[model samples]
Target: MESTTALDPATALEPATALESATALEPATALESATAPESTRTTESSTRATVHRPAGPVAPTDAAAVALRPLAGRAVRLDPDGFLGRWQRRNATETLPHCVTNLERDGALDNLRHAARGERQRFSGKWFADSDVYKTLEAAAWWLGHADDGRLTELLDEVADVLAAAQREDGYLNSWFQLMDPEHRWMNLAVGHELYCAGHLLQAAVAAIRGGVGPRLVEVATRLADLLVDRFGGDGRLGICGHPEIETALVEFFRCTGNRAYLELAAGMVELRGRGWLAEHSVDTGLGGSSFGAAYYLDHMPVREAGAATGHAVRQLYLEAGVVDVAVETGDRSLLAASERIWEDLFATKTYLTGAHGSRHRDESIGDRYELPPDRAYAETCAAIASFQWNWRLLLATGRARYADELERVLYNAIAASTAVDGRHFFYSNPLQLRVDHDGTEEDAARRQAWYKCACCPPNLARLLASLDAYLASSGPDGIQLHLYSAATIATWIGDSPVELRVDTEYPWRGRIAVAVASTAAAGSWELALRVPGWCDRTPTVTVNDEPMDAEASDGYLRLRRAWREGDTVVLDLPMPARLVTPHPHLDAVRGSVAITRGPLVYCLEQVDLPDGVRLDDLRVDPAAAPIPVAIAGLLDVPVGVVAHGFVEPDGEQALYDTRERPPHARRPIDVLTIPYFRWANREPGAMRVWLPTA
Candidate 1:
């Protein structure tokens, strides 16, 4: 069977002239600078604020203003034997190196060399290929923060040196435009991706600065950022990138350097969007003359007026991340509220059962509410990563548990399902269901490939996994709040006093979480909050030092306050029962089907697990019987699987359409085995479905 066809990045481009009158909207007055002095600025929200800038990707100058503050990169360490620990180590050992090797092999780095040597005809890879190198470099920087690797260091130095040599005197650094289209700089904003590439470079530099490495790369990025500020900051050409990301990157750069200009530039850029520039020039700028109009670039409405997510899945999510960053830093309540409203609408209607987004493959864009189709889902891996990134920022800004819950859903399902067990192969688009005859050659094939022509998700995964620990926990005025469960050591400051703790758990498989207090600098009282996942049906049991504690949770967290403790322990037991989940009636795609879940993991049935002569389409789960837990090993060392009772019905007539008056389909009792959604496709490629029809 041939694969269902769809438009990919390569086919989306064509040669066309830029519209001279695209910038018709008069440049509006710039927003007042939101950045303040080097000293921390206390806000109306919180009085007890920490002076130090909170670490991780987001560092709001006013730390206490936000609901939760992430601990510094050096504060938390995952145990090597734990689940996320293995992922981080794998990224360091396999994925990181793979990205570096591919950049060299696939001509991303060589493009820079070509530009440096003034060679114009030999440019290679996509126009946005430079972003991949930046993302990979960021992964290296973050990994180097905790682990030392000679090979990664050498590669980083080599790349940084190439980038420095290739960069023009004015801090412009794109290899493609430099070598191929020098005269059209910033001419084709809709499809050029020049600013988009620069944004990734800035983010890589920010990571390097935060991780304490790559000073030369930092210098190069700073120079480039300075150029952007000079060109677009104030009373300059008023235009926004067709793709966002520079807004967030500039804000982070401002946080790192305390240069008010970058922050002002980011704020101005955010303000300048929705003014109909990209929409006016999209077709003229050679975007394949497609029908993806204003909404495709999110130029349909202003960010503040937009209520729901639209446009390309990755683009929408990336823009939202920058919006939130600008909102938090500038203390714009209206902007923040707009972001929250859009997020609420996105989760309520647009999101999929696997926490994936983007239903339309033609444009790689988010579809209408409840329009999710399992078989045709274009839940691009980059979109999943973008969703996680957006959710992480929302979590930090509002300290909302729902944001954390969304993060867990995407991470355990969509994001985790992206990479193969070997860490080399990856799925560009994650589909919940793969028809038995799914075309293996399609760009969105169900099976993982070593690399894609676009090849964005691999390095994106690397950077996320390498920096995963920072998203697990946060510190507030009183104590630490653990968002994601993992075996790790957390050391953070609480009002000038240091506190250390060790967490032990086998999460997503079991419910037992033991938190042991290792040391406390302050003998006074402080609080520790644990997130009670929204998926927990029964009341989670909690105990302190083996004593039952009846603590009522508020805002999805159980708070326990205590003082003067060493060797004291806290244990939380959340019941883990496999349950069948049903989709909303409005979701016609899988309305009659059900999905199985245990703890934080979603389970799916692969054809390889079916009995002989049983086709995946013929199986119907027995909704009355509960799914049973079974242990498995040797495949990525995953420990658990689900066994569900179902019936395998014989295929009906061969006709595409059948009458209801046909004879009843015969059924035989069958046991269907399901692995974690993330673990599927790691084995033999076969048909798989997360939503099983119920008998």
Candidate 2:
């Protein structure tokens, strides 16, 4: 259906209920990895029992603590392979390089040049700061080992060299620090991303180190963490990060290296957030709102409670990430529930037809209902990525299909369409409509420009595409449930045993998937759960190894308890058809209108698709008419396009409704393809709508 609309957890133990979704949480990752032979391990991918992979590492209460950084570092994690392909270098390189390089050409790099010479000012994007140094190096480090091309590694090293050159004697490094607060170094934990950025760098270093290369960045992060611990202790001057992302990041670091001091340091930061001791007094320096958003990103709530999704998108994502720690680690389902409740409300209210969000650029706050103004929508590329990551984690916690469903929506519609397929350009606001040059001024330009001078999107996408290793985790005490199916293989330790899985399928298009489980143990007690997309037929004939089976189905998963060897196959049919879907009657804009859709794909009519001056709500599809499916080039791929000339009923001969001059109406074909309501402006900035009247 055309209007087929798009699509977190925590610790404080706020309520008894958690969020509802498509997947259910499997038993916790209790399998110790010490029982396997040197060649194999107690992989979480055991075919012996049904199993699920939780989002990230499970540690609650102190999840927001600074320790999670190292912990995530040491552990091998997964991200859906096709899930984040939107950020791939091949997909986004063209647009992003121009954005970052602009600063190099402009005097913006002069600011970095000044920082190189001991000067700094209001900086927008992170470049060669102490915090970014480790991360940039770590990224380059990974490229050094994994990438086929050596040039990328060199560029990363060059950036790292610049960052290392800008460091201060006591180990404090922030471009803003050098210019604005050299004397105030390490004074404010809550506001200073000095530590938070450092945490990312630490993570990058760890990723690089574990990949079997890049030790320099690792040492740099360790030293920086040491300095942070020294400065933020009970006796030290600061306690929290003004931005909050660093605390969770740091804790991940601690988990990886087993550094107790970092763990204690991370706790102090988290505690400071709850106590509000870091912001002792608000700074009036234009960044207060951003800081408040930042604080929430830390999930400062000691007790989890449900509320609306408000504030800036990035900050809110940070908050949800922190709270997820509280939920999984502490076993406080309520804290997780609170996160889920808020997220559900947010999704229901704020999400756009394209699964894009971030409406207001002024405060970067979530905007009003039905308030998806095309030109001004501020759905940042990073925001879409954040939403997917958070939801993916929740999918791990609850094992809900809704999480995966929403994740799929964002990945395909919002995230995928953010940048051009070439990986070079980007649109900060991925509105349904596209205007030629609406991005004016620094603020407006931030939305319109192919890339911002800040230039975080390119590297972000680059890194994500390069190391897409961890998303497909499997095996549990029971059996296995597939959360995401992209053609990829994962090799890692699951439960004190080494297991491998090769997932083969052209999913979202076809339902049948064959999974190759490489483990010594015979698969048993494990119930294989596969998601049947809601947009597809509710019931499918699920067969295991060509035998029809009675499956346990709910939300979207078709479950089958089976016994298996290495090569196992599960198959089903996902019907793709054209249908008209109507919105809730209460939705005033689309009260009488219906949307066109095929399978999970939502279709709309652009001016390019339709020939005449046709209004969006003026046309409709006959419920009984089968839309002619056509293959047309879309923003991302060759999508299945539908063609219809007119409504089911015939037109009149310029006569009044009851004038007795009209003949019986005849059904007309919908020859005009409706563009998505959001894709209205591809041809010069104008108007586009998704709703159409009845045939």
Candidate 3:
């Protein structure tokens, strides 16, 4: 595999058939295609897919898959009847939503035609144009499902035609797959984006099929996914994707087509864990004691040993979803425990008030435990959504309230803030503090872009937001657990019995809740539980039918095991108080950094709130200092300690000075307001610090 002077045989061919021949040519081609071709693609009719549309049928072909669209609008592949059923069924009451939406819109669909046309003008090639338009169509499919955008279908057809023309006879479809070394197929799982692109295609195909897809694109994505399974499955030479989406996508694919091979492939791909096979072939760091060394710990996971998350946010979320797959399929306590450890580790230390994770903005990866400085939080919107998705699975697996509690916080703050009023603009990085300038950090642009070096967040957010309906469902045989308290009627099965549950309450306001259950089970015994978040007010008091009852909480869930009538009502109360949370004694970042908490919301300090953009290292604030919540502009505003007054010297601009750390310094008392880092959205963004300085 070493190259010295001569060209590698793989790159020599116009069309590469193997990996060995392309390794050498890749070095040469990397320079020529710093930019890759448009990823839009189409394949011959031979590509196999469960969704068989008449060659020209360009609208909701399979009604069921497309029927349960999210409120955002678009067909999604989410159903609880099949295997790999969604644990967070509450997330998808309308459809199987993905993160991307019209997050840019001021909240209306009218601007899309104008916006799509405007953004289309910004792209260079047709392929790129189509994907950008595809995202618009994807969003258009979900949010504007009823709006007749025949132009979108036409645009998609043209893009498919382009891909059909661009694809070589050998079956590779990535715009960047062989851009440089065409022969390097199936090699370099790290950094290579083919699989991630496949996840997008899968999502896009769901939308296309719903919006009406040409047979060509459907066949293209199906073939690509199948090829992925054939190569990466345990028996196959290729291993799991460096990124995690493929596993989740393939699971959905199995549900859509009832193809056992897809499920088997998912199992095979996951089974390859702990073996250093994939990393060994590529430029990966192989396995590691820390999550950072591996590709988000795909090298060793529930597919292997349950390990803590260490790498990129997206990879961790994807891998966690895959692990959920393993845990449910095999009922392995080992995998379940691993997920618990990860959850406990994050909640006990790293999670932001806004439920954001990851500290380093540059890498979008989780930093050391409790190293969650608000100024540096890289909590991407998709990461928060994915984290909630993972937590939802954990809740269903273990029936733990902590998981559901965490999911609720992220869903309300970080995940929901991702979309704008119109639902098109998205906040990529959900920080803990506010800044004054536009940033280079990830996830800032509100609308979809043609491409970014790291483009995972856009489609990921799109897919999650689009499929939001699939996340909200009732599962397990015992009974349904009303984890969230929204006033909605959700119908799901809890055995052969169809359970229609009605929730009536304004949560996060009055902890008081009323659950109306409608089901007939012959007066038998069943346990219907409700989640009690950590922020509950003074040992929650619950009554079953307006009478005082002993509904004790054990392990964060209030378990009620008594027979009741169909019309019986259960009322529970939770108290929300403005409290303060300190860091673990051993952690350096949050030691002085005290977070203000009211219910699930966490608060922090912003450098913008400080003078001269103070570098948020460590502060010397007293541990006894208490912040107070004040009424501001009709919202709760926490008045934290005033920023210590300090003045810049005469020569503050000088790189190095002879005397002290700057000049005529003056003490200024600055009024600093604080809120959850995730809520610091839609502003000129930059770095923020969650931990504060204790005097």
Tens digits of per-residue lDDT, candidate 3, 63-159, equal: 2221111111111122232111122232222221332222222221212232323222221222222233334335434432323446545655655
Worst 10 residues of 1 by lDDT: 27-36
**lDDT by residue for model 2 over 85-177, one digit each (tens)?**
223334324433443455455444445456667655655454333333333344454434433445545555555555556656665556766
How accurate locally is residue 194 in candidate 2, as Cα lDDT from 0 to 100? 62
Q: lDDT tens digits, residues 373-392, model 1? A: 99899999999999999998
Candidate closer to the true structure by lDDT (higher is better), 1 or 2 = 1
| Model 3 TM-score (2 dp) | 0.67
In candidate 2, position 186 carries an lDDT of: 59
Q: Estimate each model's TM-score.
A: 0.91, 0.73, 0.67
Worst 10 residues of 2 by lDDT: 45-54
Give the best candidate by lDDT: 1
lDDT (C-alpha) at residue 498 in model 3: 41
Ranking by TM-score: 1, 2, 3
- Stretches of candidate 1 off by over 4 Å are 1-54, 280-290
Clashes (candidate 2): 109
Evaluate model 2: give its TM-score: 0.73
Residue 635 CA displacement from its true place in model 1, Å: 4.1
